[model samples]
Target: MKRILKRRVLIPVFIIVFGLIQFKTIDKVNMVVPAEFGILTIETPPKEVGELISAACFDCHSNTTKYPWYSNIAPVSWWMKKHVEKGREKLNFSKWSDYSEEKRDSLRLKSAELIEKKWMPIISYKIIHPEAQLDEDQRELLISWMKK
Candidate 1:
């Protein structure tokens, strides 16, 4: 009797886990920055700085997010959505041209300050995206670009 009970519980648990794993959802990957949205018509910040920012920050802060395959899973996907929404609220690089001159200046200053304090990338992000890790020189380059 005890063996039968254990089998019943294990079978259902395994099925549930398997079912959860099979469930999938589509990620929102259509992130087109408007033509009039950026300060640079030809892509700003030079190649290196632009690459760094895109890798480290654009996932949440810009319209063009490159979603990974795992982003379609539960719990993780929910968290990703929330983080992206919050990041956009704080500063949406894809909407930069919509900001007033004063607001843009303030955001640029804040971006520099955040980079100097090692606070912009958010530690959780760098853990998974090792390429997003900015060395001291990269950080300096970003700061210089932001200030300009």
Candidate 2:
């Protein structure tokens, strides 16, 4: 009887907290991406490579994020917003023109290394977005293009 009473009280409290958090929505103001400043504009890759990068990296690494439906939820949206912010801070493909030639080259080398090690398009992202899941051939193509 005590366990049943405890669950009944705890469940309502959990629901109330979840609902209250919904008021604090994530800021989506930085979503607009100008095409002229993007990496594709400066150093255009092969079609397949471009497509692969878009699928696997753009959502977090670029300003033009295509937020999924679940992003409307509070804690999840908060986590995603922070993740994307960190990704952009590391390398914003949307602001690719701002980086120096040396920086760009270094970033490319790092990208290739990460992909080769299967450390990119992280597992959480891959689970939610199957398109980010690269097969051997696709991974090889991206790695080659990044090196080039």
Question: Top TM-score: which candidate number?
Answer: 2
Q: By summed lDDT, which 10 consecutive residues of candidate 2 come out lowest?
A: 27-36
Q: Give per-residue CA lDDT, model 1, range 29-108, as digits (tens).
A: 65677746854443466878877878888888888777777687765777787788889888988888788888988988
Residue 19: error of model 2 in Å?
0.8
lDDT of 2 at 19: 98
Q: What tens-digit string does per-residue lDDT give for candidate 2 at 1-148?
A: 8888779988888999999999999987675768989998888888888889999999889988889999999999999999899999998999999999999999999999999999898888899999999999999999888888
TM-score of 1: 0.79
lDDT of each: 0.80, 0.90
Residue 11, model 1: Cα distance from true site in angstroms: 8.6
Q: Which candidate is the best by lDDT?
A: 2
Runs of candidate 1 with Cα error greater than 4 angstroms are 1-31, 39-43
In the order shown, the candidates' Cα RMSDs to the true structure are 3.3, 1.2
